[model samples]
Target: MISTKRVFTSSPFMMLICGSLILALALGFRQSFGIFLKPMSLDLGYSRETFAFALALQNLVWGITQPFTGWLADKYGASKALLIGALAYMLGLFFMAKSTTPLGLMLSAGVLIGIGLGGSSFAVVFGALGRAFDPSKRSLVLGIAGAGASFGMFAMLPYGQFLLNSMGWFGALIVLSITCILMFPLSLGLKEKKIPLKEKRDTRAALTEAFHHRDFWLLGLGFSVCGFQVVFILTHFAAFIQDHNLPLTIAANALAIIGFSNMLGSCLAGYLGGKYPKPYLLSLIFFLRAIVITIFIFCPISQTSVYIFSAAIGLIWLGTVPLTNGVLASVFGVQYLSTLSGIVFVMHQMGSFTGGWLGGMLFDRTGSYQIIWITAIFLSILAALCYLPIQEKPLNVLKATMQPIDKA
Candidate 1:
């Protein structure tokens, strides 16, 4: 039996707390980005696609750089990666406030913010936490960290709205930039001593092996749906609310509710993943997402239906993170979890790029979000089907190769 007291006192627990805080601040601000869309685009006289493209670029760059950032965290230390991430994130937000042209927005919000996200977000945080806990506790700990992020979403959305109302987008961004600086102090808790060069060789081998593995591709493909659906909602739901002639507060409240429900869902997923098959849980999640989305789209748009949909969908929102991480850690071990997870995340970000960009493009052309909504549903079902066949058992090659390293 696991001792609760021992788990609480361990050094890793401190690391987990700090890492969770980092995600909360980073992702919390990210969740509120849609708030800037109408205001920023209207003020700058840019089309929605232009703004969306910048955000899409952000996701693309984040995906492209994740492997390198993950490698940085795995090889150097999470502290170092997070420190760089904090600085980049601060600068990104600061410059984002000063930007006027499309090029400026793309450079600041797109490129710089992407670099910041690659350094500070889920992959780096999870890799560190995965290495800290044994397998039995990894999912649970990750769930706890995930809940922290959710809380940030829940809390920060309203705060972001307040800032937007009082200080304007520029001032809100400046304040948020200042908030990012807090991450530097938190990075200290996740400090890890550098690993030896031999382990770097092993990481390359693991990367090669993962490339050869069929399940790895499937995981990446399935995860892409998550990125697509979530990013679409986060980026465009405000506009969707406006199109329907609903009050903006409804959208804000819905997003906040999603964040709150996600806390419960993430924790539940972690607990369930430990006891049941992670792949099956993943399948069920996607299926439920499809069902919820289907119902929400078919029903008349109203405050009641929107809130209900938000609560229902929110329960499964970021739950995938822990379950997916659990599957990778279970199969490959944590020897180079960051590097491997980062590669898979590229697929997710690709989906994110499509969802963010395609939603705006199609909306601008068609004047309704119906096509994208249907696409999201289709992608969710496809993801459900994809996860069903994944073999979650540890790889034999990994067992043979990583066992010696574990002993040392």
Candidate 2:
């Protein structure tokens, strides 16, 4: 087991509360960006692709920077990483408000915000929590933290819409920019010491071991599907609703319902993961996603249907995050949890980039979101299959002689 006690001085409950709030603010604000798509595009005279591509680049940059930021969190302190992230995120939002061109949006919204997200979001927060708690409590805590992100989604979506209506997108982004400054103090709550592991494997060795493990790749691949589905929805769902001529309120409410439902789902998934096989739970979540997407697409498009779809989708939304990160911590140990989790997140964001960009590209071409929806269903089924073969056995780092790594 990893040296959990030497790292954190605070109570587990306190850590969870602080960590969850950070997640809530970081992810909640990020999720609300979709609400800006229509207004920003119209006011700026940019195409949907321009808007979508910037968000897509944001995911890409977020993924690219995650490993480095995660390494910083793992080796130095989460607080430092979070400090840098919050500053970048604040500036990103501030500049994004002033952006009048595609290039400006890409630089601020895409590059800067992505860097901010890498450090301040799940990887660093959960790594601190993972190091603080033992295996038994880890998943549940992560689940609870995941719920904070859900709550952020629930709370921020409406807030974004309200701000957009009252203050306009530019002013709304400025306010949101100011909101990120709160993370600076919140980052201090996650401060941890760099306690050495009992079994002394360095970062390179840990990464090499994981790279050689078939299960890690499988987990990353499976997680990519999640990125694809959620980012597409977050970046384009409002536009999708608008295309069908539904009022924006329906879209906002639908998103809120999704976020609210996921709060319960994340907690339930976390609870179940502790008792049951996490891989199996993950498999089930993906299968359910495929089924839900199918049902939603085949059903008539109405406010009631949208709400139902949002609720159903939200319940399973982001449940994958806790379980997936839990698997990495379970199998590899928490010493390098942030670094490893960050690598897997890169895969997730690759899918996110594709989903966000492709949704817009296809829509602009065909004037429908049908293709992307179908693609999401197929990817979900594929992701479900990817998890079935994963073996969640903990690595035996303390063995007298190293066993051959699983490369299959």
Top model number, TM-score: 2
Give one digit per residue, the lDDT tens place, for model 2 in 280-329.
Answer: 99999999999999999898898888999999999899999999999999
User: Alpha-carbon error at 42 in model 1, in Å?
Assistant: 0.9
User: Which pairs of residues clash in candidate 1, taking residues 3 or more apart in a chain or in different chains?
Assistant: none
Worst 10 residues of 1 by lDDT: 1-10
Return the clash pairs for model 2, or none. Answer: none
Which runs in model 1 stand beyond 4 Å of their true positions? Answer: 1-10, 195-201, 397-408
What would the TM-scores of all predictions be? 0.94, 0.96
Clashes of each: 0, 0
Q: Write the per-residue lDDT of candidate 1 for residues 1-408, one digit (tens) a residue.
A: 111111112398798889889999888888888879999999999899999999988999989888898988877778888988889889999999999999999999899999999999988999989988988899899888998889889999999988998999999999999989899999988887642333334666888677777688889999999999999999998889877988888888889999999999999999999899999999999999999999999999998988999899999999999999899999987867888889999999999999999999999999999999999999999999999988788888544544232222
